[model samples]
Target chain A: MCAELIFYSVVPSEEPGERAEIETFLLRNGLSYDEGIEIFVVGREGRKLVACGGLEQNIVKCVATDPLYRGEHLSLTIVDKVIHLAYERGHSHLFLYTRPNNIAFFAGCGFYPIVEVPGLVTLLENSPIGIRRYCDGLSKSRQPGARIGAAVLNANPFTRGHRYLIEKAAESCDWLHVFVVAEDASLFPYCDRFQLMKSGIEGIARVTLHPGSQYMISRATFSCYFFKEKNVAGDCFTAVDLLVFRQWIAPALGITHRFVGTEPFCRTTGKYNEDMKYWLQADLSAAKPVTVVEIPRIESHDRAISASEVRRLLGTNDFDRIAELVPQTTYDLLSSKYRMKAVGSHTSATA
Target chain B: MKIIKDAMAGTLESSDVLVKVSPSDGPLEVVVKSEVERQFGEQIRRVVADTLARLTINEGVVIVEDKGALDCTIRARLQAAVLRGGAVEGLDWSILQ
Candidate 1:
């Protein structure tokens, strides 16, 4: 009755040949395919894979359409299929990320733009109220100004480097927002990390610390990725995670500068910071709302301080050395005989 | 055009509507659940009734779960639901217009 396109849902990893075909398509189109998410494929009876899309939690990603099927609106169909599946699974809130040119297409498909990191990625949600709610909650206590600085920190255990970075940003801005990554995917649970950070910044009144929501989650901090391979496509999570900051988070809070500590130890984190710097400075001819500021690593001896360093020292029973790495509050918590080994660190490792 | 079976159209996405239709022995019945009920309740009913009349379906129950959709969207969804539920033959495309 309709076009001859046959739509099929396939297990991303179970079918080797199909998986390889999807990878080939993504690789050819300058996209990366992340396994473990639900994949939907469309093609004719000839077994020619023409388009692919996937659903991860409530967000849609990894969409690609073959050049031969350019006018068939395959991306839209795959998105609709995924969205319908999410709805069938009882998920009412849906979101997706696409390049700037496809934003209008998804918008026409009942999704509205929530944030845009122009020329990179655009985040859209199925409902307008979802983003409007975040904006409302953000503006309730945020002071309006161009000098307000923002920092998103996982602070696995809150270290001296974290304090130093916060101090630098706080010194420059009248208001500083510290969003502690709240995903319970690390050596410390989100509750423990939040508590440690709260005690760590007890005296810094202007530097208000907030809990990072799902949108700012790093793959290292999301438990779902603890089993999945990381960075299958190097910059997958970078574009999606930061889109929230660039579009909705920073703007509603009137944050003009985003501060990140330079990385000298972990390559993953270092790459994330580098990409964050580029995203903050990208399309500068348009003068985006927030500019990224990279502060040199807070060092101890000859090495830069990091949460991974502290975690590595935890298993060695060297409390003294670990003490040197973190702030007093983090040290107190780490030394209380309550400790756990951290999983491997992944940067921009968000889904 | 009477509904002979069950059918659904549209979705729960915002600015959209999920319409379900079922054959009934009673007169035309349409119920609406909308996010903007206070603002669009009457309008939604009016548009639904007009759409049912246009489609020539005089005996069926239509359930509309709206997420702030406009009149045109409601009409479109109702049309799809009616066509899918029954109306397999003697369909007049001009009347729907």
Candidate 2:
């Protein structure tokens, strides 16, 4: 039961009007309602619903809360009840689809990503005509300071380029949240990857790390909107990715200006820049377009240093070559028992 | 306290919950020791059942040590612990026939 200021009740009804709203919401989400199943939650004050997840047969679908009353863990309370009801009714498994952005919130409540259909995500991200918002931040009324976020996947090794990009984003924004992508497909585990980024950016005041666990970059990227190569060739992937970055990912993170490197030699990096330039020129009138900064590629004997280059050198067991590409500290990490072969190998090894 | 020790030994020992089946008519006892000391047996049980049902868990006993957990907090934490405890580890639903 919720306190007086908090609401605690579920209204079960077959009324046509109420059913219509629920049905409409479900239809919009491409889900259907079963006859025996019911929808319920304990609502809070200010028309804030404590939880409004649906129970179809045994599956628990769509756990949601009022944006205003988040962080209080009210949805968890209601979900607990729903889960209990499901078990008592002898249901097999609870399943629900949360926007990839909110995956961690559900993960914190013990839901794991069972299956991922990249197609469903592409459909969601590509159509930005009427899609107002894809995620609810900490607040409904956007704070001026809340307008900034850093979309980062520690992919583990934090390269100088990554450090520079994050540093630049922090300098430009009031608050920069560095999200570490949280899928297990990668070689470096989430914890190590998160630690690498956190420590790599350690003294930066505005920078904070969030686990990309279920909802962050991996989901968005796997959906092809982040990479945007579904319709286009490999050459145009960067452009499509940039469009999705601007339209879908940027808004959710409350970011207006994305800071990217101006390294034209790096294929993906260059693609991101090119796409960003196009998006800024074509679409960004209301918001500031992505700010592309040319991070002077670290040079060792006139050769430009990069993560891929470092990984290639390390693959050959060439410590000297790797040392030249990365910082002394990074060399120590790479030479250690934990020499990374994954995303952050370049950064972590060099850091 | 039929504390189902070692039931979760191999898989869940490294994780959270061990092996939770369905709650039988055996009073389904749950003992929660919290420093805050809020008497939440009835509602806690409800959350346990609800979360288990939602997760499609059939039966099990759950004993939680509360560190200032509310109703929802208790449920989420319990669900996490149970899932982590290896009850569903490596059980891929897509392959489930």
- Weakest 10 consecutive residues, lDDT, candidate 2 chain A? A121-130
lDDT of 1 by residue, A1-351 (tens): 545778777677678788788889877877767665665554443567777776666566677787777653566566666666665555545666666788766654557676664465566766544566656677776975559999988887788888888888888988999888865667677888888878877677588888777567543212232123343344544655665677677777888899988877667667777777765667642435578888998778888888877777876757889888887778877777455543343333211
Q: Fraction of the real A/B interface contacts present in each candidate? A: 0.00, 0.00
What's the lDDT for residue A168 in model 1?
82
Q: Each prediction's TM-score against the native? A: 0.65, 0.43
- Tens-place lDDT per residue, model 2, B1-97, is 1222212111111122212322333344344433344565566556656755565544444444444456665555655555544345454433221
What lDDT does each candidate get? 0.71, 0.48
Candidate 2 residues lying further than 4 Å off, grouped into runs, are A1-134, A137-156, A183-187, A213-216, A223-249, A279-281, A284-296, A327-329, A338-351, B1-97
Clashing pairs in 1: A219-A349
TM-score: model 1 vs. ground truth: 0.65
- When candidate 2 is compared with the true two-chain complex, its DockQ is 0.02
Per-residue lDDT of A144 in model 1: 57
